[model samples]
Target: MNTTETARRTAVLQSALAKQGIEALVAYGSGPRESAGMLRYLTGYMPANTEAFLVVPAKGRPVVVSADKNRARAFKTRLGDEMKIVKTTDLTGALKEEVASAAPRGGLVAQAGEFDMTTALHAEFRAILEPYEVTDGYGIVTGQRLKRTAYEAEKHRQATAIADKLVAHAMSIAAIPGVTGPDIMAEVEYLGRRLGADQAGCWLAVGERPAETYFDLFELTEAVGPNARVQIGATVCLDGYYSQVLRIGMFAEPSDRMKEVSERLIAMQDAALARMVPGTPIHEIVDALETMIDAYCPYTRLSDPFRFQSTHAMSNSYSDPGAAPFLNAGRDKSRDAESPLVAEHQVYEVHPNFTLPDVGHVCAGDVAVVGGSGATWMSQYPRGIVRLA
Candidate 1:
């Protein structure tokens, strides 16, 4: 929220606008929206359980449209100036009026469809702005967002550290016998919040693959038994920044085969991490991972229902980012980096997993930041599988 950061964000938007030949950009989002990050990244405001739309022109104070009831809160948070608080029923109508009044006639507007614009809104805008040009602004926003600044890197580091501590506590608890999946899950959530994480994406699976997963549950009674495998992943978000950590636990002592498999998977992951230099192309990193997997376990497929690629980088994408290569499997080869591996100031998470049917899956991972020559592990977590009992 410093002046320099504010100016930097505004400058990013302006650069995108200029490159895209846009005079102004209208970014909008509602109801657990994805575009909220883009809006929040540009402006420090984290919207509550309400919809928000920010109109950033090539100049002047940006206009923020929110529910009438949240007007005071919006100002207090300093989301934006020129606030236009409108009734829920009249939200869309109010937005139309606001944009029409402030934006120049026939000026271009870039809209992010991922979260900002709904199907109905898209139709409505297409009809209303027929005379004016509006384009899918995904490219503009994504291109700008692909690289993280120093400030964002620091936020990720803090969030990742929080996850690291939460995982340590959860792992310690999971070591006890007769502990149910839900029990450990609650502890994980609690620890995440206590460590300054405002939000937590806690994924827990017990006894192979559990059909029902409780994200925010506070209790568990089902006890984990011998050979039972539990996979846990927690994405800790601080303020508006996020970083994720994943781990696997077993209630009984690991079998010889299991230990061997885990060691092999860890080795493969280490090889990939070794290649994560600043100038290394992302595809090459993925390729190295696939090569290791194929050499060790050719029978295992790199998809769900089996051992999915675990060694990949981490970013804010809620879905999956930095998935390892399935180069021979005809998967999409085009990731962010095309050729010539990237390095330096880049952050990635190396998670390599191996799945055995009816037995369970094991995920070993750590966040890494690409330095000038190589990569540094950000989260200090055990790299191999851990037995709880």
Candidate 2:
């Protein structure tokens, strides 16, 4: 993140704090996963080998807490000395002191995120805030992340470009006479790492779709056979931002039934994509999508044998069934589909996919951006199945 962009994002969060009358905001990030997403958004700090925390007040210098002095020093040099980097052996004491500086005695303090935090870490975080009135502050960050800035979109594009190559290579390798799913994924990983990707992962399913819709990568030992109906997906992260490409390809020409279903699935996805207008309610889109999908194939995401959805939101986090843009039944009724307006620049991974005995899992999806007037495709690869014959 550049200096200007960093300042812009921090200002947005601080403005939220001021509006909510919260004294200080504590953001927890534990070791390089989705939990680190908020910390990265506010401070451009990605947790390397250890857990870290960012404490930002409505008005004051933000403090970043680190356990490793070497890691702190390296990040300081890379990020410059604009913000304070505190090397703390005593995490609770440091957090309390920093909170004291920004917050008034007996004032309210809000936490940015906690759902993904480890249990022991969560207890420690809560222990520090137990003195003050606390409220959930995740909405504050989720609001900002779902919208893609030109900078974030650029990173997504770079990741998606590499993801495209990964998918294409996997499909081509499947056409070879003898190759297991893992064999192809090994080459996919090497290709992604060689091209400057930070992290890469892929999923594979060959032959007719199994009884279950969700396919596990660990059990992907089946060899690619002639005319095997293959479904594969590839995702890579560039600077904590993720991009993915999913496709269904065949070694032989796709059967007529397969072609027809692929077109229907893509059309169903388009209908939902076009409904993503700014200011629209998130649930309204979900309801409309379900109705359209049920017209051809009766569906409800909640009842899935695997907890997947027809569409989902994504940002720096690589976790599945993302938060905002689409919310399921949960504690935060406010964030449920019925609430939360679709922001102007929201991003989503749209896939109205399902399994069929005739064609296997019909996976086809792309990253979508809702900007300017309507929806636009972030992945250069058009949404459809491929035939390598």
**Most TM-score-accurate candidate:** 2
Candidate 1: residue 184 Cα off by (Å): 1.7
Scored by lDDT, model 2 comes in at 0.71
Tell how far residue 268 is off in model 1, in angstroms: 2.6
* lDDT by residue for model 1 (270-327), tens: 7777888765666666667767766665355634455544444444443222232322
Per-residue CA lDDT of model 2 for 1-389, tens digit only, reads: 66677778878888889998998888877666566777767766575467777888888767888877876785576456656788888876787788878787778988866786778877888888877899878777776676567787677778889988888888888887778878877888889989888777687767755333323546767677775777777888776677888888876666687778888877777777787787776665556666666666543444443324666666677632235435432235555644656665566777666655444456677777777667777777655667765
Off by over 4 Å in 2: 32-34, 69-74, 146-148, 210-217, 298-307, 319-338
Quick one: best lDDT, which candidate? 2
- Give the Cα error of residue 243 in candidate 2, in Å: 1.7
Clashing pairs in 2: 283-337
After best superposition, candidate 1 residue 239: deviation in angstroms?
A: 2.2
